[model samples]
Target: MLIYLSIISIASILCLWSEKSYKKGELFLSGFSTFLSVMVLSVFSGLRNLSVGIDITTYGKNIFETVSTFGPSVAIDYYSRWADTGYVLFNYIVSFFTGNIHIFLGVSTFVVELSFLLFFKRYRAVLDPTLSFFIFNVVTLAYSFSILRQILSMAIIIWVYYLLTKGKYLSAILLAVGSVLIHKSAVFIILIIFTCYIITKFKEKINQRYLLLLMILFTLLSTIILTRYPETIDNLIDDLNISSIQLNNFGSPMRFILFLFPVLLIKILIKEKFIQNNEEYFLYLISLITMSFGWLGGINYSLTRLTYFIIPIYILFISKKLKIINKKSINLIIIFWFFFIFWWLIGRGSEGGVIPYIPFWKEYIVF
Candidate 1:
């Protein structure tokens, strides 16, 4: 726990330095600081023992061993049966170099961190990069340690979103397909993005207030309907042929409230005219709609994972809002995040067992 906290403290200071350097027009210093910030967390995450994350020990390790053992020739059939093609292929490719699971995990962590670094770079103008990076570290990075494949998929979807904003439609579509190939869960995210995109086009035709209300109503209705008639969820999962995810687990209202908090902050920012352009507003709408899926957590906690893909954009939106909001409100928001981070990392059973922070090399000796 102390190691994790220390990493966060170090990252926070580095990000602040990056922001200060950027303000002073010191591009090289700013970029180097950002790189150092990413490396700090990445190195720590990469060096962790396989015992650090539940999935890494079981499914993650098992899959890597299977692929590396059978060699790349088995990838096609193996992936077709039980695993995501891209992720399995990744394991196969990594097998060519080294059979060490630690090395594979380190590479995976670096890739995930690189994706986030690119995301932060793309949105630097719209947000305080310091806050964006910090929020990601606090809110999402730990989860990546456990759910490697899904987080990698989410990272690809972040690129998809970035491309879409740049009007690179074909490229975005191709990358979205690749993202789904990495994790089937990405299908839900793609659907959400398409729905949001369509709505964004018609947003001017409809009143913003009513559209917001409609989204809220949709969230409420969906949650109530799914919970009351769970068969609806089961049947849909059957039809979709996606039985990999078990929606049986449920989450508390506090989790839902945490997801909702940012939406409310975005709403406040909207009223304050902080949404100066269409792209920012579009991301705001996507953030709200994505978070609305959090309400469905009552039905199946797995349903909430859909919100993960939206997190990068959500962080950027919230950071921008925080930048523009009053200092008192900012302090309150920071306090809330600190409390939430403790609750999530500590109160939530160490969040995939990332508490002890044992380096892989020292695992046997320390234990």
Candidate 2:
């Protein structure tokens, strides 16, 4: 774990320094540095033990083996018994090349990270790429070590969101549909995009305070509904065709804080006139809505997974907002943020099966 932190910290520094070169039009230097950072992350994550993510041994490996041995039609039919179409198809394509699970994992890691880096380069104007990348590594990247398909869906949704922001509505919608095929959770992305569109169209008539209050009310209502009618939630999950294997009865209070703090911070920044962007505001609202739903339906693990869809947008908003603050204040903020991330990585992160890091090579040797 220490090694992971050390490497990520170094990468963050290099990325921060390279931002200067990016501003000076030194495209090759900036691109090379970003590529190196992403490569380190991809290689490390791809090569980790199947045990590292709890699901890899129980679910991922089995799925890959099924695909390799049975071929796409059989594999897809088997997985479609429980999982979504996109994930099963993904496995089928990868499995065609190699029966080795490690190769599948390696390919997945490279594809996901490369897609993210390409998107980041195109949309870095929305946020400081360095800070956005750093926050992603610390707060959300490890979670991908567990839920690979969902993370891939998230990457696709992010790209779709970028397209929507650029007025490429047709492309965004098409891509969003493709994302939903990957993971049912991505349906929330489509829902939220339409929600944001309506809100923006009525920005003049709508009261922000009323909107916040409505969100709180909606959250409470959803909680009541979830508690009193769990079957309804179950039916909804079934309707979406999502896996219901990992349902939990308790909410993650600590994770709730982790998701909520940046949200409130962004609100504060907006109120102080330090930041003003409709797209950021839209993302903030979506994060609040989804996270509130997660808290409300805390017993339903799939609802929490929905929160991952919008987290990238929140990271971008926070990163951009941080750039507008005074350097001294930003420094203090960075200190606190780093401490929180480090503490999470050492504590809860490990508890969640993301630590005691073992590379694929090491695990292979031990076996």
Candidate 3:
């Protein structure tokens, strides 16, 4: 944990010392630096040595069997593998050379981080790289898991952004299709990217307020039909069974913050005349609406899965806003993040510990 603090302090200092170089439009350099930061964190996941047996799958093994057919790709349970087809391939290909698991895990982790650099370069001057590094390291990227396919699918999506940057729509489609092959979860995001593309033409026809209203109406209607329309809702939930799983503890508080922070940050970007890019602003607006869906009247707490949709846009939106934030504000945000990370990390440790301690902060209990 101390190492985490060390990295943050070093990265923040580097960010401050040469702020002008970044402002001079050092797109490749900044993107590469952010990617490097993520790569470093990925390489060290082993040192973290954390494990959770949440994901697992299985099938009939060699009970005098010869030459297994269909492999774990088909045999493994969906939840155990994060339902990622890519993860299955990663472990499968590596199994052929040597049954050692760590080799594939390590390679996959390294590749994920490396591809992020490519993604960053594509986003380029459109984002603030320093802030990108800060979030990747401080957030959940360091946590390694057995769910390799989901991880690899995420890596592929990173590269997809580059394809969009180059206007290689065909290549983007191919990559997203490939991601779906590796993990079906990518299917939903593929649809999102497509929807976002269609909405881009509306840059001339529609405005943000109009977009926000449509988003709100869509979300409310979706929630109502899902909640009030019993037969349809049951059919869909029964098929997906996703909500039945333990909700991702994005620290529910973190969920609220990730949702609201974009509105605040984007407001700053708008004030600075920085958000005119059509595609970028559309993504930002979508994120704001996705989170705001949490507030709709009839929606139960199932919108948790929507985070997967919101995060990338938030990253883009916040990164753009960071460039306009004064150094003092960035420093303050960083400080708060450090203390937040520290408090969160130690609390997690205590929860995982054999005997949870009663910390002394609650002094009034004694009083």
Candidate 4:
């Protein structure tokens, strides 16, 4: 617990420093702080004991060992049976240099954090990247610690968004495909990207209120269908040959509340006219879509994970708009998030299997 809290505390200070530097137009100082913040987290994540995340012991080390023992081609061929080809290839490529699992973990986390930093920088005009990074650590990074492949896929998808925003469509398209190759679940996010494109293309005709209502209605209807015929979802997954995925009857009420809070916050931003242009409105819509996925967690608990892809989006959205909110309100919001993150980090570390944090050095007795 000391290790975990100390890491977050130090990173949080750097995040604050970064935000202050940016506000003062000290670009170099801000960038340095931002880089340091990310590196601090990335290094900690990379150097954690192999037993830290459940998946590390269950699959990560196995795949790393396979590549080290039998070479890349055989390891790739063997794991490709059930694992993602891109992920296997990634492991093999990383294994090619050194078989140290710690190196692989560090490198993978650096990629994820770098992609996220780029995404935040792309929207820096509308967001405080430092604040967004802090929220990401509290809300999403723990899960990333465990779900390595999907998190890599998530990073690639986020990079795709960054590329698209920069008008680099060819690169974006290639990376979009790459994300799916890394994890099939990325197909949902690809659909989201396509839907967002359609929404943006027709922004003049799209009614944000009506679209939001429709999304809420759809979520409610999905919940009913899931409750009435749970087997329908099961059968669909089975037919898709993804029986590896499991289903749950209902999601946690705490999660429902957490997801709903963001929707309400977005509505407040819209009501206050904080969303001034089509681009901002489009961001609002994407935030709505992201939160709605969490609402539909009633359909399958796993559906909640779909929201992970948009963590950067909604965080950027809120950070951008919250500037208009009163300082007291902002403080309240921060307090809410602090409590939520505390509960999540302390109460449910087991969920991500990232608790009882152990540094790799200690685990290996190298110190």
Candidate 5:
């Protein structure tokens, strides 16, 4: 915890010092910095810390049963192949290297890094050319961009975007077909892509006015419906029988801060043409809508995790149009991340909880 605080302090200082360049391609150093911090902290989340709920996800424990199923479900703990496929595939490939642990990390790292690299490359053309490879692509992906199940899907989706923008329609379609096979969430994404393509095919402009207005209404309605009837939505999504994510535990009220981000972002980023010209804005808007849908889907339902599916769009939106440090946004940023400068010492991250501004009201009075 002390180390994490020190890291945050250093990053805050860095954030203060750097204004012109925040790293490159379409990502920010802050994003990568946060990821590095999480990686280090997660080392402690082993058997002793997050020792419960079975997230280790190894082949040694249940490869046979994992293969028995179609790997269709997320329940790898009960012998689902979804988690074990990567593990099983890695075991054979790593027989040439050291132990399974090294192999696991190695392949995991490669698959993730390759996936994100492809994604950054796809958007590089329309993004801030100033960001090129370092801040936008490298730092962001290096951080924590691909640390989950659906990341491969993100990579492929961006490639689909690239092909679409570059006029490689056939290739884009092929990429979408490939992506859905990797993760079922890709299916929902494919639908969004096709819908956008159809809408934009002959449209004279990006048409932000109507899209923006409708999105605002949709967001409000979704938030109200979900908060009011969390149970009903929970039952709806959970009928597939996957374990429900603990929303109450993440102190989800903190996520309301997410809504604040694009708003705060637009405060400084509004004038930038990046929001209108770039194909990515469309993707970002729809993804944000999807995130709102995820929120409305249920409580304690992995909205944070669901947000991961849209993170690239978020980062791109920031780097392209919102990376600048204005007086207002800067002040708000401190408030945004820290809430109070002493939050770690007395509030959210103050206790041993590494998750910042989360678990909502679960206060831990650290001495």
Candidate 6:
């Protein structure tokens, strides 16, 4: 835990320095700092032990060993029986090079972090990119150590959204399909993008408040319906061929509170006219809608993973809003929120099986 905190602190400092460089138009320094920070995180995550993540020791390791032993073709065919094509192909490619699972972990971490950094670069104009990077480190980066494949899918989704915003429709469509291949939960990205597009087109006809209210109502209705008709939900889950275990796992109150915080913050920002740009407003609204859906689907763990793809947008929107507030107020709010998220991860995030940190080198030491 101390090592994790140290890495985050160093990364945050570098990000702040990067911001200073950006302000001075020192492009090289700014880019270097950002790159160095990303490398710090990626290296730390990639070098961790196979036993570090709960899933890594069990499911992740098994997949790696299976692919390494059976050869890519057989492994791909076997995994295709259940897993998505992109993930299966990813495993095949990684395993083809070596039988060591650690190598795959390292490669995956590097790819995901690099992709995320690229996405951040593209959207730096929309927010205080440094602060956004810090927020991601504190809130989402550590969690990625546990859900590697999902995080990779999330990176692809971010790129897809960026492409859509730039009016690169064909590229966005291709990327969105790729994201779905990486993780089926990424299908929610399509819904989010489509909804945001509709909202943008009909901004004058629609009320943001009404849309939020509708989301809240939908959340309540879905929760009540699922709770009352478990059999129906089970049938739906079966038909979708999703994991049955997800039906038994519900989100905690803390998770709901974290999701709600952004909704409330966005509302306050909008009311104060802090968010005036249509595209920015649409992104925040989509974030809220996705989070609401996540909360509504809290009964199913797999469904909740859908929200992860949009969390970077939420973080960026909040970071943007904070920039317009009084410095002291922003400082206090950010400090409080950062610590709260840190506490949650150290405590409740044990479900990811990332607690009691252990380094990969430790396993090879004779001592």
Q: lDDT tens digits, residues 1-367, model 5?
A: 2433443344334332222234443246644543443343233222121211123233332332343333324334455445234434433344445443423443444455445544553454444322322232222232231233355456667677667767898999998877665555566667766776566555666656766676668668757766786564444222323233333322334444434454455544455543554365465566556546444433434343344455555555554443443345543453344333224212332211223322212344321
In model 1, pairs of residues that clash are: none
TM-score for each predicted model, relative to the true structure: 0.84, 0.84, 0.67, 0.83, 0.58, 0.83
lDDT by residue (108-173, candidate 3, tens digit) is: 666765565445434546565555545544543432242345556767775565476567989988
Best by lDDT: 1
| Candidate order by decreasing lDDT | 1, 4, 6, 2, 3, 5
Q: How far is candidate 1 from the true structure (C-alpha RMSD, Å)?
A: 4.2
Against the reference, the lDDT scores of all candidates come to 0.69, 0.66, 0.49, 0.69, 0.44, 0.67
lDDT of 6 by residue, 223-295 (tens): 7876787565454222233334333433545566766775576457447565566777677677666667557
Estimate, for each residue in 1-367, the C-alpha lDDT of model 1 and write its tens digit: 5566668669768878987998899989988987787778777876888887656864467778888888644654654524378888888888788888877887777678767876776666756666676667677766677677788898898888778777898999999999988877788888777666666655664456755786789788887887688676554332322233222222445556776776575566557575666666667777767667655644554564566678777777777776666465664676467457545534453544566667887866432
lDDT of 4 at 15: 72
Q: 103-202 in candidate 2: lDDT tens per residue?
A: 7777787677667666655656646676666666666666677777778888788888778777888898888888888777678667876677668545
TM-score of 2: 0.84
Q: What's model 3's overall lDDT? A: 0.49
Candidate 5 error regions (>4 Å): 1-54, 58-61, 64-99, 121-148, 216-253, 272-274, 278-281, 290-294, 297-300, 323-367
Task: Give per-residue CA lDDT, model 4, range 1-367, as digits (tens).
Answer: 4465567668868877877898899989988987887788889888888877756863588887897778667766766534367887788788878788887888888778878776776666766665666666667776677788878988888777666666788998999889887877778788877677666656585576786786677667777887787675554222222222223322445555665575576456558575566666666777777667666653464564567777667776777766556355664676467457545533353445566777876874421
Any idea what lDDT model 4 has? 0.69
Which pairs of residues collide in model 3?
55-80, 56-80, 85-182, 85-183, 86-182, 87-149
Candidate 2 residue spans exceeding 4 A from truth: 81-83, 234-253, 274-277, 326-328, 331-335, 338-346, 349-352, 363-367
